[model samples]
Target: MNKPDVSYSIFQDWRANRGNIKAQFILSLFRLATWVRSNKILIILFIWYLPFYRFFVEWVMGIELPWSLKAGRGLKLQHGQALVVHGQTIIGSNCGLKHSTTIGIRMNPDGSVGRAPIIGNNVDIGAHVCIIGAIEIGDNVAIGAGSIVVKSIPPNCVVVGNPARVVKVNEPVTSSYS
Candidate 1:
């Protein structure tokens, strides 16, 4: 797998969540919180500020995106409510997430915690979607709403329904997002 970009610019991500006040506020707050955690001197300040951050991001915004999450650039969160992404999940660049989506891990039968999904670039996921387990979502994929994705998906496909069977494959990649 290719290495993820180490450089993180809040402005670039802000541009993606632009025109949406909720998305802008939530993402900016997350970025700032992460930045503070990354700095040794600022971590001291974060110790006192962590509670407020959790309250606002979890209770107010209704988003459970951890500051430690490795999300890529241009992550557009549409109707950013009830969205929960696991900290271990790696989301690629130019991905769109709608409301009521859960991208997390599935528990093992032995009652152990499992790994989260690694989503690829330019993937658009709709509302009421649950993408669970240690699956890999390929780039340029579009997932319909109310879908439950468990298995790994290939690149450039359109998947939907309860089990998320691939309905279309090798679809053309779109450049712009609305």
Candidate 2:
């Protein structure tokens, strides 16, 4: 029998790393709670109307996210409107995503087709950051108040402005969420 190529072998190895994938999922779920703490009011309201929102998102809105989808414990939504994430997007633990943050692939001729944004841990995405395309945001990335990200962000960095420029790097994020 012929052996698999190096690239093919690496792909197979990645596919077999199910344990790592599950660990990532669990971490994401834990992070969500911290995120919620940072934006407790919004989360509380969402909790209060969870049944309705659940019904709408799961049934009426036609936007489907599977139950098995792993998100960290501290996931907080400062505002809970006009927010959408691609199912394939890999969210890291303790990520804070505000309202109107659409992390998905844009369907345009100039846009790259397929694949979703892979977000890193402890990332704070401010309001209205439309992070489209197949981008990878590293850990501890503090996105500015309003920005559009289409490129990869290195770990321990801060990005701001429209089109999202990396104005600073390795700045500490001080959030109340734990």
TM-score of each: 0.89, 0.58
Flag regions of model 2 displaced more than 4 Å. 1-54, 58-69, 108-112, 171-178
Worst 10 residues of 2 by lDDT: 1-10
User: Which candidate should be chosen as best, given TM-score against the real structure?
Assistant: 1
Off by over 4 Å in 1: 1-8, 171-178
76-162 in candidate 2: lDDT tens per residue? 445445667775778776677666777887666766476788888888999878888878999999998779999899999889988
Q: Write the per-residue lDDT of candidate 1 for residues 2-40, one digit (tens) a residue.
A: 212222546667788889988977887777777666767
Give the Cα-based TM-score of candidate 2 against the true structure.
Answer: 0.58
Q: Please, what is the whole-model Cα lDDT of each candidate in the order they appear?
A: 0.87, 0.62
